[model samples]
Target: MDIESLAPVVDSILEAAETRGGGGDRLSVSPHSFPDAVEAAAADGRVPVIAEIKPTSPTTTGERTEDSVVLAEQMVEGGATALSVLTEPSHFGGSPEALDRVREAVEVPVLRKDFILREEQLDTVAADMVLLIARFLNDLDRMVDAARERGFQVLVETHTATEVEAAIEAGADIVGVNNRDLTKLEVDLETFEEVAPTVPEDVLLVAESGIGSQRDVERMQAAGADALLVGSAIMDGDVTANTRRLVTTEGHDT
Candidate 1:
């Protein structure tokens, strides 16, 4: 798989950071344990769906039914084991402020999903966990180490067998198999089906993207996904119902 360039987004974030004079108040520290919560949720015979708080995407535009905080509460109440907040503002219509609000409102672990490229970004992250895409990083090991040192659970995103290997080699605690092709922004559920079995039993496996129905959740569960990170589908519909649909698939064999 060809690696997609996230430099545009990274550059924009850097420019904004520079213009802000580099050093604002950091996100308040939290002692909430994301990995432990996720592991416990999975151990309890639930699919452990990680509901996402995404207001918009680069491919579409519309107002979300409720604010991030409101949605966060709904997801947790609906049976979401965790949360994934889009923190990339330019393309994904997300921001640190949104993450902060959601994090404050929910008790579950929050995954900060963004095109993270530097240690400083991790330093300021308000979520309990951080995403590091293996496709975008040249030094995956270093980035993983940096995030780990900051007391953040690392969710390494992988798109292929090679990337999965890189994620494992980098010591990823949670490995996310993203079905969407970053270059073209298209999705095929088979991507997760093909990649999930390659993940080790020790590392938590999460299927991300293109999950629209209970059948999709069952398929991922059958494919060995321990958890799921669903965004657009959950964001577009009833958060509670969508989350319940996914979580209720826990007893299936993937």
Candidate 2:
């Protein structure tokens, strides 16, 4: 989807935020260090997979009807370093309630993945981390600061080298390079490889989208990704085994 295509989704989110009114009452859950989890997995010589709890998406086929909490436990059991819960309800069949349940069910840090347009949206976020897309927001720095002030770590997503640099300038400590282009909804493994070098070594880098196999995992890791955010592949079948395949990297060429 292109930037214009996202107008309706963004509008819906804003309307929801308005209707709910920012109560600033985030769910009561113990904070887990998102970056620490990724770093620890990488330090252990393992591919840190931030498995996602995606029920449905615009690009993926089929809908996941399983309980979000059950799916989260399976991923963790399969050795996922963390979890990403999609909270966008329109295009992606997700809700904040799902994120809350998953966070309570797993010890791993949970990232609230949504097209966050305003800082007020952060008030309702209960996860350990919040995703802020650089291409979507006009003032990225303000959103980053707002998330931090609310005690939430920020994952600034970028699609190109310029976006990566902009994310860094916006004071983003964690940068995620999304391989899928929003304009065409296309996935390219080389996108991460091309943009990974632009991310500073100090910032934690996460390769997002289009990663499904052990070879894909190796490719991203080799390109300097501290972690991989995997969705459709893991959600497709046998969540645990799928997660294990990416995490263990066994029987696959190094």
Candidate 3:
């Protein structure tokens, strides 16, 4: 998505940051590691699924009103390796408190999923990992460094091959390819498949967005995705069952 389309959202986040005074004094260090969880799951011969706690999204049909902590616990029961909690309040219907609740309720590493524009925003993030969009930031490397300094692992997100290169050049240890083209709000599974080959083998690869079923999970695995970050699909109906289906889906060996 053009960063301009999210101007209002970014502005709101900045306003909130200013109110919070940009410090992590209230936050405690997370003992969990996001990439380690993914690697452990893959080593155990299961699909590494980073199930998301998304209440609503601009592209979804409706909102989920379930308790965020409850959803997070259920996802862990269903074999989710890690959890991605949306903290973008305006369009995504999420809040930082929800992320904190989920993090406390589950043992898995929690990823802060939001349109993070400024490094100051990272100061109060309690999540174990953070999502930084390669296409959104003018200096991905600086943001990555800032996140690392805060002791949070980074998942650099990209939508194309060029962005994938930018992520690597920015020193991203884990890279996620999002299938949805933010500008059009349209999704195509081929987006990840097309970009997967361009990612180096040593760097962890995560397939994000547009994954809704066992078949879709398999397709991503076959295309060399080390992990799958699923959102709306699992949040639509039964969180536990939906997460179970995707995590247990049979797929080619990575």
Candidate 4:
């Protein structure tokens, strides 16, 4: 979008990621920890599933749930590889306590899902990964190094080809191409089609937003996405059924 203004966001996020991830090689998970989700989706049987916690967007901050920790538990028990806690207060009704509660409930990697504008918030948490949009920052390498140094996985969310290239060049291993256009509040399946194939085969692609049905996951999988990060839809539906729908689009009873 607006590179000049957004560069700061990216730069600041990278600074935090590097300070945390430390100067280490890419991290891997034991396949034994994952359920059917990551195990089945693994390429030649590898890569962990990034099970993200569905968070309330800041725009809809007032419409919040009373017990997000329970939801996190359900997601893990229902078969998620990791947990993502939304900690942004302005848009998502997420709090540090919710993240801590979920982290205590499960033994999986928990990611802090916030705007991630600064490093202080990250320093105060015990998360294993951080989420950042590629289009919002300028110093991608610095941010990624920061996260990797902390032993925290960095998920670079991209919305366009330029961002994807920038992310990869900056040493990003996992990238998410969001189908939701924040400005217009719309879903363009074309976004998946356009960005998925171009990504380096090694970089895991995660399809986010506008996924209301299993067919969306199927479509993304076909387009080469390794996993799907969904929210709202599952929260808006019967918990178990929705979990089943996302975990296995093939109608397997969960």
Per lDDT, the best of the predicted structures is: 2
> What TM-score, over all chains together, does every model reach?
0.86, 0.90, 0.89, 0.78
Among all windows of ten consecutive residues in candidate 3, which has the lowest summed lDDT? 17-26
Per-residue C-alpha lDDT of model 2 across residues 138-174, encoded as one tens digit per residue: 7899889878877888899999999998899999989
Tens digits of per-residue lDDT, candidate 4, 1-254, equal: 24453344344544444454221334332212223345554532322335455565522333536487788777766665666788655345676677778877777667777655443434545566678677656766777876666566778898889888999998988888989765555678779889888899978678877766666766777888877777676666455456556666445331
Q: Give candidate 1's root-mean-square deviation (CA, Å).
A: 3.7
| Comparison by lDDT, 2 against 3, better one | 2
Task: Compute the lDDT for candidate 3.
Answer: 0.84
Q: What stretches of model 3 exceed 4 Å from their correct place?
A: 1-28, 250-254
- Give the alpha carbon lDDT tens digit for every residue of 61-175 in model 1: 6858478898898888888889988877665778788888888887888988887766667766567888988987788899998777767888999989899999999888789
Best by TM-score: 2
Which whole-number lDDT from 0 to 100 does residue 48 have in model 4? 32
Ranking by TM-score: 2, 3, 1, 4
Residue-level lDDT for 233 in candidate 2 = 87
Q: How many residue pairs clash per model?
A: 4, 0, 0, 20
> What are the per-residue Cα lDDT tens digits for candidate 3 across 44-108?
77789999999987677788898999999999998999999998776688888999888888888
Query: Alpha carbon lDDT of residue 37, candidate 3?
Result: 90
- Model 1 scores what on Cα lDDT? 0.78
